[model samples]
Each structure stands twice: as C-alpha cells, then as structure tokens.
Target: MPSHEGEDEAWLPPEIAVTVDLVILTLRASVFQVLLIERGEPPFQGSWALPGGFLRDAEEDIYDAALRELYEETGLEAGNLHMEQLAAYGTPGRDPRRRIVSVAYLTIAPELPEPVAGTDAASAFWTPVEQVLDHQVSLAFDHHDIVSDAVERARDKLERTPLATAFVGKSFTITDLQRVYEAVWGVSLDPRNFYRKVQGATGFIVPAGSERRTTAGRPARLYRAGTARTLHPPLTRPTPSAAPEEAR
Candidate 1:
C-alpha cells in the first residue's frame, strides 16, 4: 500500500466493531437470575448470549447504545432501572466474526415481565445465574465472563447501597429486605441481626405506617425506601463460620 503525501504511515489502526451487552439481573423466588437471549442471526446463531447489539449510529454514546439494545432485544425499558457500565471485553478472538469490542452494562430491577424476543433474538428468558456460572447452560461469545462480573458487582453494590430494595415492592418487611441480601450473596443472614442492622442504617428505610400479615406469623412492620442511596456503615456479609453461630 502507498502512503499519502505528508502522511505518517508507520502504523495503521485495525478495523474494530463496537457493541453493547446487558446483564440484566433480578431476584425471583429467592434465586438470582439474568436475562439471556438465543441469537437469531449467524456467527453464533441459536446460542444463548447476553441481550445486546451493535451501535445503531456511530455518533451514539455507549451508554445510550446499551439502553437502546436492551430495549430492542428484550423489550425492557431502561427507565427507572439501576444500570451501570460493567466492563469492556476486547480480547482478540472473543468474537468469531471479527475484532469486536463489547461494552457491557449491568442492570438490577424488581421482577420484570416476561421479555418479548425481538428481531435479533430467537428467544429470551430469565435463567438462574448459577446455571450459567456452572456451565449447565452455554452462552455466546465472551458473555460468560460478562455475567460473572455483573453478579459480583451486584453483590458488592448490595453491601453498600440500598440496591437490595429494588428486588421488592415499595413497602416491604424487614424479612423481605433480608431475603434480597441472601439471594444475591448466596448466604443466609441472622434475622434479628439483619433487622437491627437495616434499622440502624441511617435513612435506609422509613416505616410505612402499615403491616402485612403472613400465613402463620404475626403482622410484620412495613417500610418504604428512604432518602439515602448509599450505606455509610455498610452491612457486611457475615462469614460462613460466623453465620451459623449468629443465626442461633
């Protein structure tokens, strides 16, 4: 190849494709699940992967592209959802088609409605995170790594933020909140201790002036999320050795 006049041609940039992938997570039935889609097109057709797509416009911001892909692939809106940039995966050969770089996003929300698979996805559904992590189910591209990172991020966020409440309704019981932590962290917490810690956390939750009666237990006090977004004195997860003793 010939270089243009007055142009430095020592090196040339490689052609790369940029895309977005979403690891949408939620706590349902006390299990952590992630949204995955079966790719409808080639280069991994019929394989399960995180819901995402290439940037529709070169001028679009990465985050905006993520939101658009999320909605387009899964029919889930990004409004009122807790979404953040997770990590970038650009390892060569990560994508079979070409040198594709992916910017992944993580989302946490309460139980979302059944997703309608869009043009890019043959099918879409929420699958337990354990299944993906355990290799019980396969994922397309380098999505396995993306999902793993998203789960860890979610667990970390729950310890220092009011994110757990996103798993439940506006007004929830202390038990309801505790379950969210247990599901995401994959450990049981002491009921009494968890209650005390949550109540002590300044502005984490405020009493909703109501109670809900369970099947066999007495009425449980209800609470609504408060002003505070992050926890000052974080609710650290109890070690496995200490958890058993604390529960007693």
Candidate 2:
C-alpha cells in the first residue's frame, strides 16, 4: 500500500480563528458616537479599533464571547442592550498574523457610563461617527467598513422597528425620539412634520398620562414604548433632494 500519511495531512483543512467586534453606539450631546479602544498588542498596536477579542474556549456561544470581550476591553455591561450580530467578515488578508473571521455586532443603548480600559486596551473612549466615517480618525483592520454597515443597519431598523427607543428613557418626549432619528440619519427633520408623523404611526407610542415642562417651552407630553414592535407602514426617510435645504 502506498504511504497514506501525506495524503491524510493534505486532506485536513487549515484552522481559522474567530473574533467578535462590537460597534457600541450611543447618542451623546445629540451626536451619534461609537466606542473604540487602542490596541495594546502588535499587529496594529496602538491603533484604534472596535472593542473585541478572540473567542475563548470557555465561551459556549459566539454571543457570550462578544459580551465577555466587550466587558474585558471596555468595561461596559451587556445588560438590557439592544444588540444583534451585524455581519461576518472573512477575507483572507484581513488579519496580518493569520486567517481571521470576525463576527461584528451592533449595540444601541441610552446614556452609557464612561468606559474604563481593560488589559487588552491601552485606552477606551467614545468617538463621533462622523469622524470615523470621514477618516478623520483611523481604525485598525477593516473596522471602518464594519462601522458603515452598523450605521446603515441602525438607520434601516429606525424605519420599521422600535430600535429608536433604545436611545431614550422609559418615558420620553417626542422631541427626544426625533433627536434620535436626526442624529442617526444626520439630517434635521422639520419639527412639525416629524411630530405629526410620529403621532400618526399607530401603536408606535402610548401616552403615559404625564407631562414635563421645559424652561424654554410649554409642557411636552410623556410617552412610553407601545406594545407593537414593528411599524405598520414604515416611516421612510426623505431622499436627499426632498429633504429640507437646512438639513443639507
């Protein structure tokens, strides 16, 4: 019989590593921002990157790994966050050391606390999305592409899902909700038109039997998230040409 050792080795597939990258988004000071960390290790050492790491053997699921890495790198809890797997990127040369298949996750939350950098990160901080997208700040690996995808996902969800509520408190004003849309869409919506559309979207919000007054304006009614999860008829965004000139 011919030697089978070489044949067996040739049939074995090469091992590839899996990592989880987080695009943790929040509305800060009316601007959309994402959490990023500076890598403490080589292969993009000192470069800013999404908070994430490789899947550990102890983690039974990819999501568990994502949560663990997020906390380990940024010290942010995964509690009550609107999180979902955004996409998978597995291009051969994405990682310099070896083959890496990264599963990117998108998370949205309201008023997160300041981040503390962990062992794998030199420093952690929130950076505005415009700076990242506009290349004012450089990101390690293919994180720029990942951020773009996450932003688009968020914008789409805002149209048909209750995702916008993730950026607000239990009881909030219509203006608060409108700010979320404006920040994510990067456009100014006409206040009167936005208020009307939101009220018209049945089951999108429920009056909470309360109102709060602002120093500069009349009392605004408080509302809570409604029972319906999806918008009946999606609240579509205006096209560039149709959007208000001031918004441009």
Candidate 3:
C-alpha cells in the first residue's frame, strides 16, 4: 500500500508553481528603505515591484533560489546575509501567470550598493518604507502585502532576535543600534533604559574593541552583535504607534 501511494505521488503533476521574491530592507539617510524594481514588460509595465523570479529546475532548494533572485536583481552577492523566509503568498489571483506561489524572503543588510536592474527589471531604487505604507507609492502584484509582512516581521524580531544588528555596520555605536530599533519599531525609546536593557540581555552584544566620538557628545563605544543570535530576556518594548495593523 505504501509503495502504491509513493508511486501515485510520483505520477502527480506539480499543482503549484514555485517562485522566489525578496523584501530587501536597509537604512538610507536614517530612513527605513526597501528595494523596488520597475517592471519592463507587460502585466504591470512601468510599475514598481519586489525583486523576484521563477524557480528553475536546476535550483533544488527554495533558500538557494531566493538568494539567487536577490543577487540577480540587485547585484548583491550572497554572503553572511541576514535572511529568513518571510511568508508564502499563494492566493489564486495573486499572479496573472499560472498558479505561481512565491516564497518570500526578508533580507536585511547594513549597506547595499546601487542596484543594477537585470533581465527582468527595468530599473531599481531604494524607496523609503513610509512611502510604501502611506500608499504614496504603488507596487506590482501583491508585493505591498509582502513588504508589509517583512517590516512587521523585522520589527517583531528586533524585540526577540538579534536581527537589529543587521542595520548597523561592521562596527557601530550603541546609539546607532538604538536608532535601528527606533526606525523599525517606530517608537522612541528612553536612551538610558534602552542602554541598560541591551547590556543586561546576555549575549545580545559584545565589545568590538573600538570607539568613536559623536558630533555633540564624548567618545561613544562601538560594538557588534554577539554570536548568540537569539535574544534571551528579550528587549523591552514601548507603546506601539497609532498605525493601522495590516491583516496577516
């Protein structure tokens, strides 16, 4: 009976097509930013959209496909990139082309070079997150939902995961780390309390043997995220801003 079931499974057609989409976020000019690409072809020509592509036969893993799409669209070579599966957007009408279900990934980077649009993209640029949320900008497909999901995931992760460090450079001041939290969470934190909380959270941070002076203050200490990726005794949270919560 098991053999028969396995044989039946082998003969079944792949009901859903697979694709990879990326929600790449970064900070530019102290503003939360997202990478968007302009569509060069029909279906949604001239509109902005997330960087993605169809999964080919050679790519056997979803994670690999996602990284490939990221590099292909943005010339961002995959390294120790902070990446995670965001969500699966599989609504039947989400795509006009067949039954394509995209496995979206949220990738955060400290710095991204200027994006060079590739075969499927007309042009690409980093757009501020505020613009996307306020509907001041339009996105192709259900990408707006994808982008929203990514932001919320990142915001929540900042509280319980060491994900906030991705926004800071190789070495960063404590204030710089605080800004990453503020930008994503959209809540201003009490500086003194935030400092103490992070320090008390075991393995959340470690000294980088570096220091730098700020414009209006004394020399500030520099640190990097510790090897322990998960935040123990998670960071404290302030009140959530009066923003409409998108339905997940």
Against the true structure, whose lDDT is highest?
2
The better-scoring model by lDDT among 1 and 2 is 2
Model 1 scores what on Cα lDDT?
A: 0.87
Alpha-carbon local distance difference test for all models = 0.87, 0.88, 0.84
lDDT of 1 by residue, 32-139 (tens): 899988989998999999988888878999998988887776566777677889999999999989999999999888877788897878999999998998999999
**Model 1 CA RMSD to the hidden true structure, in angstroms:** 3.1
TM-score of every candidate? 0.91, 0.92, 0.88
Q: Which regions of candidate 3 are displaced past 4 Å? A: 1-15, 241-248
Which residue pairs in candidate 2 collide? none
Q: Least lDDT summed over 10 consecutive residues: which range in candidate 3?
A: 239-248
Q: Give candidate 2's error at residue 210 in angstroms.
A: 2.1
User: How would you encode candidate 2's per-residue C-alpha lDDT over 93-156 as one tens digit per residue?
Assistant: 9999899999999998887778888788899999999999999999999999999999999999
TM-score of candidate 1 versus the correct structure, residues matched by position: 0.91
In candidate 2, which residue ranges exceed 4 Å CA deviation? 1-10, 245-248
